[model samples]
Target chain A: MLAWAIPTYTPAYPGYGASPALMLNVSVYVMLFMAILSLIRISVAVYTNRPVCSEEREFPEDLEGDDGFTQVGRMNLLHLARVMIPCVLLVVAIEYIGYALASFAFLMILQYLIGSRKWLQSTILSSVLVAVLYIVMRYGFGVPVPGPQVF
Target chain B: MEMIFAGLLDSISPASLMFLLVGVAVGVLIGAIPGINGPMAIALFIPITYYMTPLTAIGFLVGLNKGAFFGGAVSAVLLRTPGTPEAAATSWDGYPLTQQGKGEKALRMALYSSVAGDIISTFVLILIAAPLAAVALFMGPSEIFALISLALTVIAGIGTTSICRGLIAAGFGIAAGLIGTEPVTALPRMTFDVYQLGSGLSLIPVAIGLLAFSEILLQLERFTVKGDSEHSANVFSSKLEDRLVSFKEFFSKLKTLLRGSLIGIGVGAMPGLGAPVASFMSYDQAMKRSKNKNEFGKGSLEGIAASESANSSVVASSLIPLFVLGIPGNLAAAMLMGAFMIHGMQPGPLLFKENAQLMYGIYGSLVLASLFLLLIGRFGLRLFCKAVDIPAMVLYPIVIFTCIMGAYLGKSSMFDVGVMLTFGFIGYFMRKFDYSYVAFLIGFILAPEWERALQQVVIISENNTFMFFQRPVAMVLMAVTFFVIGRTFWVSINDSRRKKAEQAMSAEQAKNG
Candidate 1:
């Protein structure tokens, strides 16, 4: 988590006139309190032999027989990894390849991973969605979609 | 009076009216789809509204909120799934009604009650917002801090079954909010010297990550595990006349509708207590008073009316706090506040005084939205019902694309996208752990304001924080805060004890058998 932080600091901002450490101190105290409370909660859960987190066992009984997709199913670790890895890579790749190509690639890859039966249909849909979004952002809303600057 | 008339005309103008219709249509479509909610939709649309006039933008968003409330009920009735958390109570009677082939009746009841409740609450907001804002103007910084503290405590208590977990989430949220430069000194506190962190996390990224992206991740798990039961074919049979509800039958439950509206309006006006609480509470009350209580979880129209009315009414009445005190009552209102600030309008006492015309314009928009909700809902009910059949596999990937687009568009920074993804993971964990994300969100939204108010109090009292005790309003608010926390703790303890006892009894029964 600390790796996300920048290493250096400078007191260069214009408004740092009398330090308002009071608010900062209070916020830190609240965080400490929360940390302590979380410890206590875990301790209680262990002592009671109850699960620390509610187990996702099945869909709610009311939705038991529905034909439509249910959001809660068994945790698919492999499927999750397959989706998450590429998503993270896509975020990184966007900086180099730009949003248009990165988005199109991300969607196509994700659709295949999620088990899209028709590769041609997935490709066309991904292209159409990406084009529509790019046109709307670049032309309709005037937001600049990054082009291939590095590549 | 003249300004009010002008504002009314402005709201009803062709362009504004068109946006309102669009907002309602979009909101209803999104809301009918499971796992997508109003807050996520609103957050996603915030950037789009950057080019819109303030009145049209606000009118459109407000219409979206109103339409989503009723749209959620469509899935609850036909698909036995809640499109939003607030619609969970609707499923108690709604799904059963569908099984009994009265899905259309249930949907119509939900629609009428939602609109009736929403219109009444809008009237309440219009009538009370100005006077409330006037009263809020008199509060000192100390008084305001105490009031916020009380609101946080109440919210923490009512938001979750476990008050301790709720407070923990809120505390973490406050810490998260305080990560940027300190408000008074402008000195970096916990930014770790990151330039992006210096501005604090943008509300858009955090909101989208928590509400939208996290949901997609959670829903993705469904792909791997197939259900045991064979999928029931023809969830909604095409015999339309069998399900149509008559006006006379709906009118028979007018008393339940009014009761639910009152409960909704009351809960919505209070910060932290939101639509779910109001809907469940009203459902419980209606069940207790019902002549045919046995029919409650088995397709009672009155039960559907009770839950839908109460939840829908909250859409309008929750804006009361935001309009009067510049403090958002819930996540949806917080998003609305962001829209207001983006349009260069601050929401408090001065807003009513300086922007009376705009306030009246907003009120006019609400009235127009209610009428639009009725028309669109009546004509487009089948379309929304069909929306439920959309597969999660296709829908969620598209939603993810939108989420990313929204995060990037907010500040046009990749750092914001990273922030959104990180928070999405955090939100997923929070949900699994039974932590109240709503409390966390409210805490994050209020932290900056709370700190600023506390600083003002310290400066005004010359650093004598004890002076808070001397202020009658401040003292009263503090006392209320303490009382609420204490009561919540007591209730939580008793609940735990009861659960333990039940567990022990079940063990003994199994041994005897």
Candidate 2:
């Protein structure tokens, strides 16, 4: 970050009192200092509070529910993948299948994955929603939706 | 007075009224559903507002903001879950009231209290905003820089558990803001030769990504992992009298209502303290002052009044700084600032001089929104309560689609969509790490102005830092900034040490036992 903050263009404009990159440099450098301090603090705390060696060590129960840091600390990678993979695929699918078809599929898939166990109901809902959205946004509002590149 | 009347006429026009009504309805629907918030809704809808006139669009958003506060309390009273974070305090008494079969009465009280607080705050905003802007007009770049510095520090200190993490998030935000072009030289410094980044990251994509898209991802995780738990929304009381809040009953708690509104206004006027803090503080104060203290957690009307009023009042009072100094008081206000800019209006002291009628028009709409909230909350209460049963499966998918559409429609650029996706992940991680995304957002929004002010100060001072001393206001603001940072750090350190000592003693006690 410090190296990136170095001014690439040094020639000052007439009456310009400071380097153009002055604010940029200050922000980056201060952030670096704070980051280092935080790292040191974390290191010291961890060192001082070393875990006891035992065959049957009891882990503390995480009381902070879904609203807190427990979600991040013990991240379910598979769950994340399920959510993110579809999102990424939707972006790609939009280019290939157009916005309406892609959105319908994405919505149905996400709904099914998230617990709408009945596939037929999810499909009908997704289709009606996509059709209405496409008509409203494209016709009513005149906002363009992506069309299939291949078509 | 003439200008105020003209603004009122404009805001009451057919087009303005229609947009405002729709915005309020949409906002209420969004807020009544758990997992969506006012900021996220505003972010998602900003792209849609690209088609409307400036006054109409702003009035619509303001109405939306007002409606959401009241809407949040609906779920808090009906279900144990709060639709918004600020409503968490409301659920303490509100949910208990639901359990006791006075759910209708509790919801009514929450609505009445919310509207009452909103009207009072809107009135206060109208009374003070112009004068505050007039005073702000006298400040120079040095004072502005100092003021921004103070705001950034205070927000970082109060918006998070750790001031260090908040400031770090803000630092990264400022750095992100520097990526497009150098103001003085017109040279790109941090663009890394990306041609698309020459114009910098667009505000719509960033806002929608951070506030809306990231939220969708979080909700998705919660739903998929936790397995959607259905909340029972069975209203126990079917009696008409139990559902109604008489005027006498409302007036009986006037003291609590007034106290909560005042606390909300005071907190909301300050940047970063936000509605959650204000609502909790009001709840605590009400508990302390209440004669029947035991009723607080056991379905007290006063407790609901305190929490609802404080959170609702914050919706308008938080706009005080945004209107006067062009500094956003919270995340929603920051998004409003972006909306104002998109409509070709800057929201500083000059706003009064250049667009006084428009400002007054917004004020008129704000008052109108309170009335609309009352009407909607009275009639649409049952309909919106059903929003909680919409299921995470259905709602999350739709929200995700909206996020995609909002990001895509901003500039019709694929790169912006990619930026949205990237920032969504960044926001998710930031929230997980307990960083104050509010501080990050405020920092990002204010970075350009901060940079401009610094540049001006540097030129005026001829590279000498001592000029701040000659300016008393600037000097004082800078001093206060340092003082706040030092005080926050000191308090944080002391708190950690106390916690460590307590833990050690508990461990020793366990060993002895």
Q: Using lDDT as the measure, which candidate wins? A: 2
Model 1 lDDT per residue over A1-151, tens place: 1222221332333432323544445545665675687578768877876644332323343133322222432344465577677778878998888877898999998888777778887888789888898888888888887545432
Q: Please provide, for model 1 over B300-346, each residue's C-alpha lDDT reduced to its tens digit, 9 standing for 90 to 100.
A: 98999999999999999999989988778887998898788779887
Give the Å error, residue B415, model 1.
Answer: 1.7
RMSD of each: 4.6, 3.6
Residue B384 CA displacement from its true place in model 1, Å: 1.3
Residue-level lDDT tens digits of model 2 in B1-513: 888889889999999999898888888888988867898889998888888889999988888888787778878887878889999889999888888788889989999999989989989999998999999999999999999998888887644678888888888788777678777887766777788888777888888888888777767776667654658564758887677888888998999999999999999999878999999999999999999999898888999999999999999999999988898989899999999988999888989999988988898889898898889888988888888788676677778777877887877766777788888878877766667778788888888889989889998888887889999999999999999989988998888777667768899999999
Tell me the lDDT of candidate 1. 0.79
Candidate 2 structure quality by residue, lDDT tens digits, A16-89: 66676677777777678777877777677567763211111111122244221333435445666677778888
Docking class of 2: acceptable
Which runs in model 2 stand beyond 4 Å of their true positions? A5-17, A50-75, A148-151
